[model samples]
Target: MTIVAEPQFHVLAVDDSIIDRKLIERLLKTSSFQVTTVDSGSKALEFLGLVEQEEEEQQQQQTSSTSGLSSYHQEIEVNLVITDYCMPGMTGYDLLKKIKESSSLKNIPVIIMSSENAPSRISRCLEEGADEFLLKPVKLSDMKKLRPHILKGKCKDQQKQHQKITCSIDITAAPSPTLVAGSASKRKSMEDDTLAPQRTRARFSSETLTVII
Candidate 1:
């Protein structure tokens, strides 16, 4: 019997309210994902090992580190980031922007949740690279939407890897010898079919009548 391994997706849930954090954690775990909850955006960044400096130099300097989060908020390998829009320190929108800008963590899918459904806030988050925006009190049904974004991120990563591998190989190696031979054989067969049959002498036309003037 082949035992299939289930993928474990880790989620970082950020909210200022402990109750909300608990609720989101329960929702995510119910959907079969590993969950990590944080009380504030600053703590969330700390867990991710990100430096929270608002300067360009600080951001660049932090991202230079090989191992953990930097000033640019380089993301860890967490599959998803789901955060409340309203937070005490760094807002979800801020975290979303930092994650989107970081080269290492930009591919991870991000979701923003807000108690108030402001169209402008939703639009801004979407424009800044938030994959989905959920209203406050996210339901179990919202879990379904999360999977698609995660799958899309995984597919994109796969495509990038495949592209890199393809580019490193020789383009001349694309046409195999067997494929070329088969193509040539097919062309030859087509030529044979289009050619007209050779003209033959009229059957039994041996008696030729010559007109004498």
Candidate 2:
């Protein structure tokens, strides 16, 4: 029998401190994740193939003659982003906002790490769409929390695809005319049943994030 190894998850780690960057890289590697470390949040955006639209427009106005055409293409699919909350130029909160605001990158999981255990800041980050917030000096145990979030992201994408497929099948595989006429009320009930879970999920997501710090 041939055995194949599972593909490693790719993570983008952003921090201003070289020591912390090295530490995170080492930890993630030891946890069997493929890690890319950047020294700044802006660089993280660039690595993710994103730029503020306003900044790009300003650059175009200032240097249109000197520069060629621009592209906002993502070169890699990063499963997760782990960033330090405090940085020189763009704080991790700002980076988190950028990622969540982007249509293409919004689905990727983002984790914020801070040395300070500020509840208000944690609440703000969670409200801003951070998947997980970790207090500084992240441990191997914290690394375990990461896999669930990543798998959740993947499951969301799969659910969307499944929904699409189900919709298509329902449209094409219509019930027999006799059955449709006789079971109209039953069909309505089934439709209601199908939609109820979706509404429940929406409500469940609105619930506050559990603080892991």
Candidate 1 has a TM-score of 0.64
Provide C-alpha RMSD values for all models, in order.
Answer: 23.0, 15.2
Which numbered prediction scores highest in TM-score against the true structure?
2
Every candidate's lDDT: 0.65, 0.68
- In candidate 2, stretches whose alpha carbon ends up further than 4 angstroms from where it belongs are 1-5, 54-73, 163-213
lDDT string for model 2 (12-123, tens) is 9999999999999988876657789999999998877666686765534443211111233343468899999999999999999998987556778999999999999999
Clashes of each: 2, 0
lDDT per residue (tens digit) for residues 47-67 in model 1: 665554554455555564333
Residue 69 shift from truth in candidate 1, angstroms: 6.4
Q: In model 1, what is the error at residue 29, expressed in angstroms?
A: 0.7
